[model samples]
Target: MKKELLVLVSLFLSFSSFTQSRESEVDRLNSIIQDETVHDTTVVNTYLELADQFYLKNPDTAIYICEKALSLAQEINFLKGQSEAHDWLGYLKKDKGHYDAAVFHFKRSLSIQKTLDDKLSISNTYTNFASVYTKKGKLDSSLFYHQKALFLRQSVGDLNLEANSLNNIGSTYHTKGNLPEALRYYIQSLKIAEKLGDKSSIATGKYNIGFMYNQQGDTAKALSYFLDAKEINEEIGNQSALASNLIHIGHIYSKSKNYSKAVKYTRQALCINNDIGNAYGRANTMYNLGFLYKDQGDLDSAYVYIKKSLGLLQQFGIKNGVAACFIGLGQIDYEKNNLVQAQNYGEKALTLAREISKPEKIRAASELLYQVYEKQGQGLKALEMHKLFVEMRDSLMDIESQKSIIEQNMEYEFEKKEALKQVEHEKEIAISNAEKKQQQLIMWGSVFGLILVTAFVIVLISRLKTTRKQKRLIQKKNKENELLLGEIHHRVKNNLQVISSLLSLQEKDITDEVAKKAIMEGKDRVNSIGLIHKLLYQDDQFSGIKMQEYTQKLIESLSNTFGFEKGEISTNIAMGDTWLDIDTAIPIGLIINELSVNSLKYAFDKERENELEIALTEKNKQLYLSFKDNGTGKKDDLFASDSFGYRLVQSLTRQLNGKLEIDDNDGLHYHLLFKSYKRIKS
Candidate 1:
């Protein structure tokens, strides 16, 4: 489709290069218009011709002149001049990518031309109308208008316009993937152009034929036609056409696995496109280079070029080119043994291909995914993808069918014209009588249907209201439940706090050192458990608590319990938003509390500042907890039978199904490992 646009625009440029010499033309037209002897109609004609010449080089000037001409034509009641002015304005809109406005202007011109019985202008507007629809991707509507233009041109004996119409039809067929039909129309256009000795149309016909052959896998024939067209395009200085042909040749070479030739031609095309600032041409060449590098096993180079190509294609809304880039990316990832990445890219390509309705792209993506799944030993998925690939491949024309279609396409076109004439005759009769009867039936049917529809709507609205009310009630109940759960945690934390305070009071009254120590240790353990409920009640989400914040709070509580000032111990905690469910957080919190208490009691020196470090992380389904302190190493009898706190730490780790290791060489260091709770990614 992109090549069609470029090549077809080249054909138009051959006939429409008045802009190349617009300065002299503008001067001459102005002189003629200013002469009082000249007729007003001739002056108006000069204005329109002057505007056409200015259109490509200066759209604003063109629009101004067209409006001036239109105003004069309307003042003089010149219907033909007004229609021509409107048609040129439509062309300006179409050139500027304003399809809707183009359609409006074309239709307005069409009404004026129809009233004036100007068949030539009418047919020309029809062609303009079809082109705007083509640009809008409304292929069916485009074809209808194109056919109207063709019929009008044929009737009026406009051989050149008829040939252009055929070429336009061929381009539409090319877009629809009916290459055989496209080639037939191209051949008809080529015959007409040769008869008329129109070099531009002849070159365009050859290029279109080459494109069809290229799509059909005839590289030799396609290359021969492409070179012929390329020679003419070079002579005429049609750089866009030349660049597109080069790109096609490069693609053919790549498909045939001629890497050096592919790279040379593709890069040459890219350079030409860059010089011309042709974004579409540049993107197509880049995509080919991506495939080239991928085939050469340069995955990194392939990735960069393909990603850039995808960006450009997406910018231009070229879905087919975007899908091709995804395919290239998928292949690169597959080659690099990134199976998941490959599958992701391949699936995206498939989805885009399906969206754009390009079967070949769909087949390519499915085939790639099939290979990826096969390599990954996914037999069922591989089989499913293979089936899809086969279905799309089977739906395409095989070699014999393509040959048959090409051979019969001419006969088919002739019969189609006769069939269309016959159908038109019958359609008029059928539609007229059908409409008369349909109007009467529809009048009564609407009344009955409206009654039923209104009743159904009322019932549906009532149900919708009820459903929304129920949903709101359910949401309210869920909020109430969350609040109730929070209150329960808060009450449980208060109870634990009461117990901790009682232990603290008992420790204050105790005389024996062992009894005081036991009561203090009990209070610390109760405080650790109470902290978990406090977090549950206070946090926004009860599902999990951030380990870093929780650790900081737990360490601060330990410092308070041991009466250690900030200068006595410096704590560094770094977990970085790592979260754990209460199930895991409780045990980990208690373990850290016991270890911190032991370190504060015996490991630290009173005269020196102590440093404590704690970190928690989860990766690949494993949780890591680390605690280190720059204090006196633990005593050898720390794990003795009477060491209740150490024993408690051991039992807690066992409950968590975790392993605990100690490193006491320089300072007391404890590392814990266990299976992590299910982690939710943000």
Candidate 2:
């Protein structure tokens, strides 16, 4: 928005020269409009031309002409002409300092442009509205509008307009006492203009920078930049800009007390202003001349120049210049000791200063009024004037203080915003870091868990392999033990068969009962050992013996051996499923052999159908074996004697880790109890 205002101000300044002839130009254009029998579009164009010519000098006339043009365009539905007329109307109103009206017209123009899709004109309207706000001192609003203009222009690749906006914003900052901010924007503008080869814009930015530096009291730096700007303007043949730069440099020299150099520059500026017919510039140059002469103590020359400057300023409606001239005249009168005239002049200056809101001029006039009253010997009046002087001085000081405070607040707010942005950025970085760490931990955790599972699988596989190996070893040892037992059994069986054959032959030759009985007994012992081998070889698993099966087979084989199958003796076997290791199996087998032989020999004494029973049971890791029979009762004294069969039974029972018992009545019963052997696989 400020940018647009600057452009407007530049345009106003540029066209200021036309103000002298503007009425005549408008009149001539009006004559042309009246004489032409043109179409609506041509008529509108003529009216717009006349409007533009009269805009600065006769805004009301310009407005009238623009409205006529607008009506014609609207009647014909000539959008382009309508848009142009609205823009001109806005410009006319803005030049007349009717900012609100100007804004309304500019907005209307902007809407039309948008409807027409005229991007360039839309930007222009935005800039125009921004300029109106800036002139009205609505700086923030102006800035907003200018930014809009800048953005649109930049989007359209209008470098010149973008730079102009930058410079305008800088100028606003300058007015707001943001020197550093202003300098930054100015430098940015300068860089863009330089890159675009826009010498005029570059020169303008340089001149602004120099002026800002001058205002900041950096005269040496300001002078350097001004010289650069002057050089560029001269090279580009921009006489008006060159003259302005020269005038500013001259003022700086004047302030530095370089009167001779000041005079030289001021004279050159004056010549340019006169050639260009710029009333305002001419007045400014004249005022500078007055100051130069006044500083040099040439009162006569100062008076003449100051009066001329005052006349020009009044004619141009330059209020600040008029106040300054009045103050100068007051100073001259006070110096001359013309107290009444001095007081009058000072009051006049004070009135003008207040009207224009020029505080420095007010302060100057107040001080001069106090001096004038002091010289006139009016002590009370002088004291009052002194008080007024002090009040004005203090008020100016307060204004400066307020301006400083405002500047500080703005700076602090800016810094605070920047700090907050930095903190937010850091927080984002921290969050990002934390997320990255969490992801890494999850990744590593998953990897470690997989490793642990893989290791457990490996251990389980190893354990299974070891178990299989141990089982194979045990099986092999069991097989070898089985083979050894089988061999013993085969040898025992062979010896038993030979003994039986010898007995048969001896029975044929000797025909003796005692010899036959001895042979048969020997044969029975050998057969008992052979029967153990038969049970051992019956099953593939040789870890332990099946006691019930072994006992049953032994009893049946013994019945066949004693030739009891056709005799009147019957044997019954009862047992539970019980198994023992080979260590216990051999002893138990021998014990069973003795019991069975005795039962067959003595149990059926009368041969009237006798019964024999054998039983084996195991519980709680203990084994029991029993034999019973029904026969003619044997005398206790006869069984009590140590017979070979009885001795064999006792020895075998002792070997089996068992105790034996016997009962005699109508039958005999024998029992043996033993600790069962627990098998441990290799």
Candidate 3:
């Protein structure tokens, strides 16, 4: 037997005459839809309204009517009507177990509501989407949408909707078995509901908390909360909530083995459900009473109640409830030793449970069937049923395991955050202690001024001697480190020079001018990197290369290599003194070498009126390098043909994570921007 305390509370608020009022309202909307004189928008709205009212009662009819409304709204070009229709369609489709279709409609409504800039509609649609996703067993997606709805509702200052969003999120956590998170959200919702003085919402919050406590096996706490919710619901004349609370309290009594109290409360709940015409609630209570009677050894009474429940649930088209009723009947038959009849009932329950995708019911039914088959000496059949039962049980355990891992992660994050807050609090305490120590020092200094002066002089001399010794030691260590780094860089530069010399020797034996020129270019590239280490060896810092000085020296050396006179190819360097670490310096030097070599070879005329400009600067933590040549503009084959130098520049730019911009407005201009890697002392 099970109590059907809903995981998520009802969206609509309860009232004394809610059902009667809803019936009358539905009739009125239907009358409007029938009238030909009404505007298309009005007719569409009436249809949507009627469909919402019938959503729980007759979902298929609701879907049909909502479709009509949607069609008419589109014909009339009424965007608001269309959005409302889509949202209602989502609600109806979700109730009918069309989860994917329901999600589609919800998203469609959200898209339209966003275009209209209707905050309330957008928030409502988000909440509905979350509800559908939750029903589809997607807990993370459901929570995300609920959070979105909460943010939007809070921004619009709609405390009522915001509370509903919080409660819905709590339901998602509850389904995932994260009771602590569920309780937190529920309590937050309760606070908001109390602030807004929303009686129905307050009762919903209380009922959900009671249900959570019930699941936790705390009957005393659960019963107390259930009683509180019942009192409030009764005073407000909300029979639906009152009945739900009564039934749950009955469940608590049943768990504690108080059969008499359980029957009493459940029967009272049943009568109230009947009075309110709550077929679903009444059927659920009847099923619970059947199980109670069966446990008390009254098989005949159990059969009557279970049969009635099956009929009622069947009429309501609730397949899961029907499957549960069949399981109860099968158990009763098995108890009576009617093995054949028991097996038939068990198989029927299993089929319906599987059809409805109710794993718990399927497992229960399979277990009963397994017993019956074993009694009949059908070993293979019994084994098959046992396997099904075990498989379903294991599946449930796997789901629980996943949820436990998620809960552990959440707990770790929460503890980490709390630890950080505790550290901050400790820091404040430390500051307070420091202030007290300073006051104590001031008082002591006044009382022993003369003696303290003599002692202070002695301490000052000792401290001065110690500080000087430390300074001299640090200076000696720093000097040793600088000398070691300088020797390393000097050796590296010498090795590069040896390689360049070998390349020059190889160039002399080459007969082809093109091959010899290529060798010279390769030697030039090696020299550019060697120049950076040479500068590091010369400077005292040995931490970074000075770019301005390196650039001037590079231009002078390149001029001599290319046999370019002063007037023939003028090189102007305009930049402030900037220091870069070796990592950044090597790449910049190579890029400069390639561009300068390319310009000297192809970007000049016989008139000797060529100019090249190089500038470097740092701004906003970014380094900008600009290179321009007032010679011929870029030729068609300059970057189009994938030459080694052109590709190398592109590759090096990417390695630096920098941008390369080429503007051919005046001449060929290259602008590169990258993060400046400045040298920092260890």
Give the alpha carbon lDDT tens digit for every residue of 46-99 in model 1.
888877655644475678778777887888888888898889888887766676
After superposition, candidate 1 runs with Cα above 4 Å error: 1-106, 116-118, 128-138, 337-348, 372-384, 398-403, 406-682
Error of 3 at 499 (Å): 73
Identify the superior model by lDDT, candidate 1 or candidate 3: 3
What order do candidates take by TM-score, descending?
3, 1, 2
Cα-lDDT of candidate 1:
0.77
On a 0 to 1 TM-score scale, where does candidate 2 land against the true structure?
A: 0.46
Over the stretch 432-469, how does candidate 3's per-residue lDDT look in tens digits?
66556556655555556567887656655655565566
Against the true structure, candidate 3 reaches a TM-score of 0.50
TM-score, one value per model: 0.47, 0.46, 0.50
lDDT of 2 at 682: 22
The backbone clash count of each candidate, in order, is 0, 4, 0
- Would you list the C-alpha lDDT of every candidate in the order shown? 0.77, 0.71, 0.77
Error of 3 at 245 (Å): 1.5
Q: Worst lDDT window (10 residues) for model 2?
A: 1-10
